[model samples]
Target: MTIWLHSEVGHNQDAKKEVKAFNSEDVFTTPKPERLLERILILATNPGDLVLDSFLGSGTTAAVAHKMGRRWIGIELGEHCHTHCIPRLRKVIDGEDPGGITKAVGWKGGGGFRYYRLGPSLIVKDEWGNPIINPEFNAAMLAEAMCKLEGFRYAPSEDIYWIHGKSTETDFIYVTTQFMSKQMLARLSDEVGSERSLLICCSAFRCDPSQFPNLTIKKIPKAVLQKCEWGHDDYSLEVKNLPAAPPTLEQEEPDDRPANSRRKSGKGKPRQASLFDMGGDQ
Candidate 1:
């Protein structure tokens, strides 16, 4: 396996280019391909097995999957799906990395991605500029929104990000942006924490008695508001102007599968997720 550090290849240039990219909002976000791929590979599949990324972004998952000897299916929405996503994946697949550094950083070249995309967000906004969230805020949306703010990939297995506490034994966290009401707190205090537990979590806002003994709640992250991208008639920023690259099959068949399968036919290497995921989940 060829390992190339992105810093050496200068690929993080893309990441550095827009340290403030989230400040306003472009159309779509190009997930730190390496970072997100690292997390996805961790939570999802084992090498040589199939991997799926609903949000292809700049084709990071595809590139990583190929390099790690895994077959991947990706879905994306935006123009980059064709221009940015396809081209990037192709570069890695053909071992024609111009980034130069990823290759040197141990990036073993190989593999490819099949892109995909879904339709626009389900909710509809009105004249006054208020977002009309679909019937309810589902777990996926909440997870994504939380990740967008925290600058991390949304992971199902990893719950609870401890923000800060007033003291060594006390702490709080902004779990989900969905406003955390008092009733919810009572329930969580019962389950998420105990009389001795030092952690507390809340959503967008906390409207409850502050003297709840061992529990504390705070508003959702302020950066979430600053970093959000609003859309037409929507209050909370929308991921507008993004290259709507819906997921589509770029490659024709899955040839790599047979090869990796045959090579490790007897080793019985238990499937493993990406190494990066552990950092985020824990």
Candidate 2:
């Protein structure tokens, strides 16, 4: 068995020092030490492995993962995502952060990360209590949302207006908030050709369903309402809005063995979890 001393893996106090070094004015209340994360990563992963932290409090996991040369994704709901996480990660990328396992891992830091914000819910109720597509969503956003509902991959074609997404090489989806007339449908049907199939989603359409065998026409809001939950937005897993109680630390008996007495194991390759897999669980 191997032993990890505070000197090797660090403790909460060390985490405080690291956060304070980056943001002295507003330190995270409960942060994990970077050395602790380093040890976890060293055991569980290798360079280029993806690391994911769902409840990324102060972005310690991401920062440490980046320093250790692992790809990382961090999800945060609170405002600290803008304040603390972004700045701390910028320092890590620019090789400005010298604290934590930066020295031990020799992390000179050269990497980048993408940030994406979730848009508002797609379906909302109108004044008459009928389900309608949320006005907050623009054309592109509506197209993407419809693609997901219909089990199609959201990839808008650069050359074709009718191709918003695809289910197969021959099957495609088109989304528009405009009212589609029979003439418009005929034009689209002609353009789509006989070999390829297209799923047309619109606000309203005046066309016979049997006329276009290659095109499957569907109306927005109505077509998607039965597929997914509507008008509910709070997706957090927290049971309550109350502040979490302070953690109680367990007292341990004093160690009689020397601090240098510890065991190290050789690196092993374990299957790493993807960010998508982690997100799906949540």
Candidate 3:
């Protein structure tokens, strides 16, 4: 019942307007991904069940739900409101056309969703237009920011996969993009870090080796960056050659419906989950 795709778009710099990579006919730069909607629906709800998308990027969730015959509502606050969300959702409702996944899922498509926009990113500020700093930030504040920016959630007690003696709740980490000071590190480690954890660095290395006897340092993607020109775009054929967008594909209906239900042509019957997994909310 559910699936997901990445959030991205393929814009034509020359045109300034391009359909998204998944559904070229339905455009959105930061689409939430129809597959994510599919997976969510498959696990959480059934046909006629209601769904909600708080950060409705390009209304991908709404579109997927509509095509699946589910009632859905979306909340978003960004350029997508008109430039992307509305159009993408319209395409879904009309079952106009789409790429691979929707077609594969067999969406016969006759449903709709409601859209709404709330405010803005909580990290932003109002009229003064200046970023509000946490004057009294503690370990938690630093942890959350560091995690959010890096696409990881900060946790003080969880140990991630560092290859050294240090242990705490973290996978791999770095100081914030703005600052990577020892003071921040000390706070994160709860101060007395006689033994440092594994460290990965993109630039020059710092910190006294004696101070962190337990630390392990590993360079990442070692040769990938070195082989390419520094600091500029490196659209290697590996990535640049991806399909312009998902193929202009529509889903195919399964042939298992009963003849009486044939009058319905389809049922947005949400999918079932795999045996080994719990189908956690996407």
lDDT of each: 0.45, 0.77, 0.43
- Across 142-223, the per-residue lDDT of candidate 1 in tens digits comes to 4454443333333333444433211111222234445656786666556534322222323455555453444544344333
Point to the candidate with the largest lDDT: 2
- What does candidate 3 score on TM? 0.33
User: Which clashing pairs does model 2 show?
Assistant: none
Q: Is candidate 2 or candidate 3 better by TM-score?
A: 2
Q: Which candidate has the highest TM-score of all?
A: 2
Query: Model 1, 282: alpha-carbon shift in Å?
Result: 24
Each prediction's RMSD over C-alphas, in Å, is 19.2, 17.0, 19.3
Candidate 1 achieves a global lDDT of 0.45
Winner on TM-score between 1 and 2 is: 2
Clashes of each: 44, 0, 18
Ranking by lDDT: 2, 1, 3
lDDT per residue (tens digit) for residues 250-281 in model 3: 45345453322222101122112211121222
